[model samples]
Target: MLLEVRDLHVEFHTRDGVAQAVNGVSYGVEAGETLAVLGESGSGKSVTAQAVMGILDMPPGRITGGEVVFRGRDLLRLKEDERRRIRGAEMAMIFQDALSSLNPVLSVGDQLGEMFTVHRGMSRKDARAKAVELMDRVRIPAARERVRQYPHQFSGGMRQRIMIAMALALEPALIIADEPTTALDVTVQAQVMELLAELQREYRMGLILITHDLGVVADVADRIAVMYAGRIVESAPVHDIYKAPAHPYTRGLLDSIPRLDQKGRELYAIKGLPPNLMHIPPGCAFHPRCPLARDVCRTHEPPLYEVSGTRGSACHFWTECLNG
Candidate 1:
């Protein structure tokens, strides 16, 4: 396995009280496979990625429990120096906003080359050469000239490509991309996702694609994990989940997407807002908004139960959900 997370829980200690962000989320990804985590905002998708990267803030956010095992090693147990050494070379992440995630003062080439210099101890001259090569690999036009340009000089899509190039620079065993194509045109989104798919094939790396846009991930993801209120409510192969969603929330998400085939029909939408993290509801977190919610769903949390071989759901009426 390239990565394994078991019973992960993350909490934040605000002045108000503790906010239970991620609760007992578990998933794994092997080399060359892609696991797309799909959920609306505040579903703990980005928080999970931050935890995996060991970048969660300590005073406010705390990893209450869990284990992040990567390549037979538990990342949570690694020393600071040890983890730092492995971060860029063994595991890398692409943040949501490349505009803010990238430093403005530095030229794009220097930023990309820093990874090589820090991890591989390459000289500035050699690293700059490698940076130009990376830019070309991501299909950035005018690689040599663009290398000297700052982050502010690139378009949203081009800036995103730069981020991808940096993430893949070391050929890390795993890459955690948090909405890599955000704020891009539809055409650019397609291009960025395709580039990621091609790069993953070449590197044989495990990928955790965190996004709310199921449309972007439909083609690349092997498995999909549906998260709600910090927990994974359902998980299965992408095809199985889309074809036969066992959880009400999963069904609701799929229904929300507009379809060309259903031309005259009103677009389906899940009612109500996502529960607040600071003051989440008891029991199954999705209970309040779930169409098929039962009395048990209100007060008694449902554990993820096997709906079929290798597929699971947190709903009380998994069999009935299939009929929906």
Candidate 2:
């Protein structure tokens, strides 16, 4: 396994009581595989990413339990210095907002070359050459000249490319990409995703694609985990998820996707908002909005159950949902 997150739980100490941000989350990504974590805003997707990256706000947030194992070693057990060394070299993250992530005053070349300088112990001259190569690899035109430019000089898409170059600079074994194509046009989004997929294949690295875009996951993810109200509701192979979703939440997400085949019909949407993290409802978190929800769904929390050889869903009516 390249990365393994087992029974991960993250809680925030707030005035309204402890907000369960990540509740019993568990997943893994194998070498050369892409696992997409799918959810809307406030579904704890970003919080989970922050936890994995060890960047969660410490005063309010804490990892209550569980282990993040990479290559059979538990990351939670590592010293702060040890984990710091592994962050960029062994595992990297491409955050949602490149503009905010990049240092405004630093030249792009210096930022990119820092990976080489810190990890590979390369001289500035040599590192800059490698940086240019990486920028070119991510399809930024005229990388040598562009390397001298500040982040503000590039367009949104180009800046995103620069972020990708920086993330891949050390060729980390695992990458967590959190909404990497956000704020870009559709055309640029396609290009960036294609580039990410191509680079991932070339490097044979495990990828965890965190996105709200179902279209992006459809294109590149090998497996999919659907989250709602801070917990995983469904998980399965990508094809199985689209073909037959076993949870109402998963089904609702699929229904919300605009379908060309359904011409002249209105777009479907999942009604109501995601539950508040501070006070999630008892039993099924999604029961309030689920059309198929029964009394059992409102009275008791359903444990995730194996519905097929390759899929599982946390639903009392998985068979009903599947058959319906």
Candidate 3:
């Protein structure tokens, strides 16, 4: 495994109350493999990624428990300086919003070059050349000319590509992309995703793709983990989850996808809003919205039951769900 997150728990302390952001979330990604994390907003997808990257805002956020093992080492045990060394060199992240993430004052070249200058101790002249190389690698048109442009100069899709380029600049072993395709039109989204997949294949890097778009996950992910209220409710190979979702929440998500065959039919939507982390419901966090929820579901949290060697579901009636 290139990365393994075991029994992870993260909490956010707030004036209102302590919010359990990530509760025992566990998953792994092998080198060259893509693991897609699917969930609605506030499902802890991004928070988990932030924790893994060691970039969570610590004043409000704290990793209460769990081991984030990367390349045989527990990152949680590493010192701040040590973790910082590994963050971009060994494992990098592509944020959701490129515009906000990129420094407004810095030119694209300066921003990308900073990684080389800081990590590799390269001179400014050498770093600029490396920056141009990265832009070209990510297929940014007129890389030499565009390298000096500001982030505001690039289009949304191009800016996203630049984010991917920066993450790949150091040739990390793993990459965590949190909604890399957000805000782009459908065509642009497809282009960005395809480019990412191609780059991952070329680099053979482990990839953790976090998004709520089922269509995008279907196209790029090798395996899928469904999260609800900070917990992983189901995990399976991408195709298997699409063919037969074993948990009500996963099934609801699959059903909610717009089908080409059902053009005129009303869309299926999961009824209730996601539970607030600070006041997450007892038992199964999804019990209130689950169509297959029973008394057992309301009274006791279901453990992730092994459905197969490579699949697991956290629903009391997973068999019924799979069959249905």
lDDT of 2 by residue, 201-284 (tens): 999999999999988899999999999888889999999998989999989888877876766467667778888888899999
- Residue 277, candidate 1: C-alpha displacement in angstroms: 1.5
Q: Sort all candidates by TM-score, best to worst.
A: 3, 1, 2
Estimate the overall C-alpha local distance difference test score of candidate 1: 0.92
Model 1 C-alpha lDDT per residue in residues 1-324, reported as the tens digit of each score: 889999999999999889889999999999999999998889999999999998899879999999999999999999999999889899999987999999999999999999889889999999999999999999999999999999999999899999999999998999999988867888998898899899999999999999998787687899999999999999999889888899999888888888757675786778889988888888888888888887888899999999878788988888999887
Candidate 3 C-alpha lDDT tens digits along 1-324: 999999999999999999999999999999999999999999999999999999999979999999999999999999999999998999999988999999989999999999999999999999999999999998999999999999999999999999999999899999999999977999999899999999999999999999999989999999999999999999999999999999999998888878867675677899989998999999999999988888988889989999999999999899999999
TM-score of candidate 2 on Cα atoms, chains taken together: 0.97
Runs of candidate 2 exceeding 4 Å displacement: none
**Clash counts for all predictions:** 0, 0, 0
Candidate with more favorable, higher TM-score: 1 or 3? 3
RMSD list, candidates in order: 1.2, 1.2, 0.9
Runs in model 1 lying further than 4 Å from the true structure: none
Which scores better on TM-score, 2 or 3? 3
